[model samples]
Target: MRLEQITYFLSVAEHGNITAAAKSLYISQPALSKQITLLEQEVGLPLFERQARGVVLTQAGVQFQKDLQNILKELEHAKKNAVLAGRAQKPLLNIGCFDGSYADDFLPSVYDYLKEAASGQKLVIHKCNFLEGHEYLEKGKIDLWLTLAPSWQDRPGFLKKKIAWRKGALIYSEKLQVGKKENPTWEDFKDETCVLVKKSQNPGMFQHTLDTMELIRLDEGTIEVVENIGTQISYVKLGRGYCFLSENIIHGSKGLRCISLPGERGIEVVAVWSEKNAAVTNLMENYPI
Candidate 1:
């Protein structure tokens, strides 16, 4: 019937003795008995059977006690969750990855460090469009963005950090003989077309390929393919063209050589975050390379 009455009844049911329940509740025996009697009257049923030494629960009392215990546990749990929700503390870190596979090798190490650094912080990486990078961070859709370098460079109100410059190598068949690996040059690739993956298929990978094209300042034309990586490799093996691939990408693949270029050229990778997001900014600064 009432909160106090419910508590008093539970106490007596637990001890099965009015004297013991009253002593535990810091109340007189008569007071505890009167509260139990009122609770039984409100419920229109007897909850306990009087015995010489202690009280025994009635059939209704047994069911009522089980239900009351369950209800009280649920109420306590709800109150705890309500307090947490009111605080508005979201310990989440969402990352917009230009290409998850591009950074897959290093992402785990980064995740390990963040987990060790802030055990409560949750990290999530979602593949995102390279072109819509600014909007992702601006709209708070992502806490941080990992994209090709210079995309966020020169932009005000944003902080940029170079995460990687993947080692670049030329992937081609032995038939071309463009240039020796010992003395690689743009002139070797001159007049030769490069095969690239299409953005429609993999936007992030397409952007990385474009970055490679831009880095070498190749004036040559490009052939775009869709659906799979084999298409690009096939072009090279068939002597159709050469495609620039990151060293890791070309490694362990058959029918092609990963030629190391002479000059310092690579797919520049960077992490972008808004300066206004102090929490994210701090995370980016301390993030392991």
Candidate 2:
């Protein structure tokens, strides 16, 4: 069916009255009715049933409308993106990030690179959590995802590159001498309650450290687990307990003592993108970090 016919059909379906649809479309009711009738003939089925008060979509019309709506949305998105791509001197760059350590380690380099490459193009950086970033990437809404989460081996048609890895340390109040930095152990916290950042699907570098170290004997009954990092840090700052964080995070945070564990691996930073986004990824990769 023609786009006009689809538009007429959708308008009528929305208004539930041919007169109202015709008014909204700036067309006469006869013209609107003629188009709807032609559309029904083309499909060889009645699309709507008229009632005294209004109209309702037939079973076939209901299914057809659902599919048509999806098609229309995709077509509109493609048109918009095409227009944006055509007008740009440089490609539009949309980057999604989770938290601060990434901002500290990789962002400066990525920013400088984009500036040199985008010379005149638009750059959009959205600071969002993992779930939101992943959703945006899957929906073709973003060009790059820089995060501290592990690579997804099962996900297809994506490029995953490791930028850097750094060990993590438990940070506590420097004012308190609860344990020595050289040999900080669980034994040090035998009777003391410690603060922990809540578990998450897309954990940062310090996630594994927290998971491995605390799993053995975490008196879950005693551990104060807060979902927000800001709250976790605040509790640790008050000397209520200590929390795990990447060395990079430690460097950025103030008034905290970073105690390294003897045998733990640091967090890993990765740059991920869809295969279709190679141009943007290459632009990011070749740019100096």
TM-score for each model? 0.52, 0.58
Best by TM-score: 2
Residue-level lDDT of model 2, residues 1-289, one tens digit each, is 8998889999999989999999999999999999999999999999999999879999999998888887796587567667777886666777777754435776777677777776776776767666667877888777888776552332788777776666766667754456434555556655556666555634542356456465545444257777556677778777787766665666655666776655755666677889887676677567443
Q: lDDT for each of the candidates?
A: 0.71, 0.71
Q: Residue 11 of candidate 2: its Cα lDDT?
A: 91
Off by over 4 Å in 1: 1-90, 173-192, 197-218, 225-240
Clashing pairs in 2: 166-266, 167-266, 205-267
Candidate 1 lDDT tens digits, 1-289: 7778878888989999999999999999998898898889988999999999999899999999988886786476446445654664756676777553446656676667766766666665656555545566777767778776634544788888877777778777655666335555666676677887666655666666676667667745556564445567677777778887667765554556666654776667777888898876776678767
Residue 116 miss distance in model 1 (angstroms)? 2.1
